[model samples]
Target: MQTGISYCFLLGWLLCSCSETKSNHNQSIQDTAAVLLQQDSTSVFTTTALVEDTTVRFDMSEVPSEPDTKIKILEIGNFHNNEVWKGADNKQWYGLFQTTTGYYVKKTIVQVKTVYDALLDTKYVWSGKQVSVSDKDTCLLLITGISLPERNIDTVVMSQKTIWPSEKISFTVDSITYTLRATGKRQKISNEVSDYRLYISIIKDGVEKQQLLVVHDVFDDTMTVVMWVGDLDGDYKPDAIIDVSNHYNNHRPALFLSGEASEKEIMKKVAEFSQLGC
Candidate 1:
């Protein structure tokens, strides 16, 4: 009888210990859950606060004109994998680099009002030279900057617009009296190639200045086209001198003279004139 009683007591003690162990394990799980919930709540609140502050700051920064205005290019830099720009979507391209002013500056091949803002917290790698085509066809700019691995990426593509002016002039084919006039603001042509478009002023008596035939005979790809008003051949009258050379060649310096002078005098005087750099 004593042995049976001792066995019963031991079984009861074992059951009690197991129950306590299970309760302790459950409590530990609950404690961990509470800590995780608290951390999540704090994180959410902090993010919300940051978002609200950023919205307000953006509104405050709105102004008529940007304080630090710059020009943006549609296309810049060389391309990786030797792939060229396919000209699918005509977006301006820009390449940002650290400038001497501590702020980043960009050089664009396209003509734009200002440079696009540099990306924040993004590190651009200039491991290889990349080439980009400007959105504007008149200005073919080549930029040397960071390379992007993907195409049509919002972070890589620019939204800025590039404006280009025409470098082609309309001249008459007849050698009659006429007046030259500038139609609009002169636009910048590609600096890589020196070819500018200028309106000619033809002043003829008893002749409709607009009706006279003006033919443009000098359009050079390698020469710099320049215009000046001066007197030629000891004549006190003002004559137009369009120097068609880059001051390097000595033979047949192309000249365009518009006045009452004969074609022979235009050729002789211009050939004798010295060359000047553009």
Candidate 2:
């Protein structure tokens, strides 16, 4: 009877030990699954945070999708009656002209398209050569090619009177008065050649601001003349047309548009005028 009792006790002990081990294994598995689920949740949260940060850093609406449509104004002028000094090689060299009262200033308004076309225009070619000069005497050695002629101003009526470099030219655009004045300082190019530059000032609401307008460099004997300033596009804006000529020859007119219209709009107007052969 004792032996049978001992056998029953051993069997019960084995069964209890097996059950406890199985319970511990199931608890371990549950803990591992919980840890994996927490890691996955953390990964998803981190990804979401990164996306939100990127969205906050960049705003798509702030970037422009189109080209610049603002109006661009370019002024053209000439430097004339420049004195030529002979070099040691007996070749004539041009001296930098330094006079505010003897040059010409012209303003031209063009669109981005016109500028592109002008850059690609093959009619006018610019070439220059450097002349050898002695160290004692400073002279300009580079000489550019002639200015290309425009058909529109070839027969247009020009001013018979001479416009001095110091003359203050004024025009009204959109009821705002703009005055152009030449500073008379020589615009130096590499300390050899120089041209005349003009300043455009406007008074709006009793505030005045001066802007620089660069014109052509005048190397030949020429005269400054104001061609015309009026409305050309019926946009109620005053358009200024100026030119530099030599004894009724080599007439070059520069057209300027000053108004509320954008550069793109001005380019369209120029294109239309070109189609009309004007």
Whose lDDT is greatest here?
A: 2
| Tens digits of per-residue lDDT for model 2, 80-141 | 11111112123122221112232122222211111111222233321111123222222211
Candidate 2 clashing pairs? 77-216, 79-218, 109-256
Worst 10 residues of 2 by lDDT: 269-278
lDDT of 2 at 239: 48
Write down the TM-score of every candidate. 0.21, 0.31
For candidate 1, the TM-score is 0.21
The backbone clash count of each candidate, in order, is 27, 3
List candidate 1 segments past 4 Å from native.
Answer: 1-199, 209-227, 234-236, 246-260, 263-269, 272-278
- Model 2 CA lDDT for position 79: 14
Q: Which ten residues in a row have the lowest lDDT in candidate 1?
A: 152-161
